[model samples]
Target: MKILSKNLIKLRDIKTFKFKKAMINYQHVEIVNHFMKKPLILVINCGSSSLKFSLMDPKTGEESLNGIAQCLLSDNANISFKVNGEKQVLALLPPFDHNTAIVELVNFITKNNLFEQITAIGHRVVHGGEKYHQPTLITPQVKNEIAKLAKLAPLHNPANLVGIEATEKVFSHLLQVAIFDTAFHQTMPEKAYIYGLPYNLYQEHGIRRYGFHGTSHYFVTQRASSLLQKPLEQCNFISAHLGNGCSISAIVNGKSVDTSLGFTPLEGVVMGTRSGDIDPSIIFYLVEQLGYSLDQVNTLLNKESGLLGISGISNDCRTIEEQLLAGNKRAKLAIDVFCYRIAKKIASFSASLDNLDGLIFTGGIGENSNTIRSLILNQLSLLGFKANEQLNEEIRFGKQGNINDTTSRPCWVIPTNEEWVIAEQTQHLLINKGM
Candidate 1:
């Protein structure tokens, strides 16, 4: 295998312009230009019908801007854009999807002069398949590559492309880049990603274990090495991102040698409403025995499953925990099943990584909910991981910190920063585009 250099590209002093001409901002300086050491970046993470954006300073590693467009297609579609901690809401017309939300977002930014110094725009694309393995400047070819992956992530990639297109229209002269959610795990070897199925199917259809949450995995790996004060090439860790969606990743020498999410986010550990790691036979069982259709079974696994289906209650981990405290048997069952699955997956990832340095918990459930963190680590005693209850409880809802003892493998609560990564990449690609 060819060895790729472990290079860290700094975005503070970068300026790139490709086919798109660079925006000429040589005259009037903005407030950001006064004491700025880092380039300003605009990042867009578009969901099925929602758009989440953030502004960041790559030099200072600070997230300095944020925006959210929720219920994008609803009658009450509105957007919340923030900067310097102050946020404003702008209501859009009826049936505003991601395509329209992005346009209005650009309008708001223009009216407020928010984009006065925005160097570039970065899009969080859900899947890049095996072709795009790094942050790519959005050109005709790059946009086509992202569009091809839409079949793999219909709910996400389409919306991502929409934002990319709309941004190109508005920020016509600025660099637009794509940072895929699957790029970080492009380091995985074929043996681990290949299923037991025939080789022809994979070769013909481009089907394999294409992991999700690459950005979250990337952030946690860096944080792990930082906490250990070890070079990333010498650090090894497992990252578990547990929210409405959950996936575990194994990091070896700063790369994702393996990951829990396979082919799609639906294949990982159980999530709020998504079934993770279910036997394929279950689908047949539901279809033949339960007389259910394939679409129904698909909905079963992707929606009406996991904690929601198991507990017969809400899928929110907090709600399920509250129900458990109220003596709900089904809720307790759901919580137990979720934690057990996470522990089991983490143990497997440890074997894949071998010589595990530590384990990290991010995402909503992983960062907060000390009970779940405690439960997960309790099952990990055999792996030399022990969390301090007091530390875990104290940081249940605070800034990122550690939860494990000093002598432990170095487990901690590192907050996931996909938006930050996106923003940084945006600034980098913008600066590099010209060169």
Candidate 2:
């Protein structure tokens, strides 16, 4: 393999307009710039069953278009989008796959002339192992490295690659970038990332912790630092990102000291379906004693457990809360367990830092669900973290504010912008390469 130098080009060497004129296909560049006064970056975040995308002005972080292609490869697969403020959903034909869905997206953008303004594309890859710590321009070499690292993230990286492949087919002329979710957590010390398994396994096979949801954690840390009037490098925080897939991060001096999700997204606080931090012996017990296959066990842990397993109704927190209020014991238990795990992780992560500057709540559940925030903070109130109930109640639906009393430690409800982070990284890489 040919080695690429770390600093191949510098941003100071060229201007963006001149770079665009020199690098991009002349006809497409003319059409792209003619329709927009600002260069737009397209960000893609792909999952097993969904594709989320956004078009944003990288310099201002202003979004122009955003949406998702959900329930892929299913009968109900659909594309939902909003452009310039109007929203619509289109039910795709049956047998819709990632490539077809991406093609549909491209058709819509081209039909509306939105594609002309897009300058570059950014993709979110979940795991990078040790190969990547920074966002990289997507080349053939980088794509091969991503495919090799899929062994460490079988579920996520594969789907991420699907998005990359699909996007490349439709937007061949624009530059593509890969932003690894594991890159930010590469700063974790050995003591935190190393597992208590055979030393040879870790050495030869890379069987160590590579935390997920790092993009969300890093974005919140930067936001929290700004809200607290402190430099990012001087901040210390415990960030709880609660959504379909949840994880908490302990950030020290702006770097991830530790995080909840492990080598995969499955090892974290209980998420919508994933089982987090369960006993390793359970797998053996199921396979050897109860007559289960390894694949079945994997499916159970990754898809059928967590709130869904416990509540026996739905995986959504909102649905669980509704059932709990209607006097369901299992729903209550699921919520209790979820809150307990988050509180426990917060306590443990606090010890990782000399002193906690503040706590940030983000992601879907963390930002919108006041009940979850109150429950988690109440568990930590004895340690000088108290939530202002009225304040918590008022902050929801993309609103951000401090939800803690003046006498207590700072607590913020900051909605995460993972797509924006990807765009920022993509733009920075382009600028550095003098493109």
Q: Residue-wise lDDT of candidate 1 within 1-435, one digit each (tens)?
A: 011111101111122211123333322123234434555788888877788987777656676668899987899889998877888898878878776776666666555545545767888999999998888988988888778888888888888888888777666656678899999989999988999999997998878999999998898888888888999999888899989999998888889898888888899888999989877998889999999999998888999999899999999999999999999999999999999999999998766765888888999999898999999999998999888888989886646888997666678898888888888766666556542
Model 2 poorest ten-residue lDDT run = 1-10
Tell me the TM-score of model 1: 0.90
lDDT of each: 0.80, 0.87
Cα displacement (angstroms), candidate 2, residue 351, comes to 2.0
Number of the top lDDT candidate:
2
Q: Which ten residues in a row have the lowest lDDT in candidate 1?
A: 1-10
* Per-prediction TM-score: 0.90, 0.91
Model 2, 51-144: lDDT tens per residue? 9999989878898889999999899999998987899899989898888878777767666666657789999999899889999989899999
Instruction: For model 1, state the Cα shift of residue 174 in Å.
Output: 1.0
After superposition, candidate 1 runs with Cα above 4 Å error: 1-38, 432-435
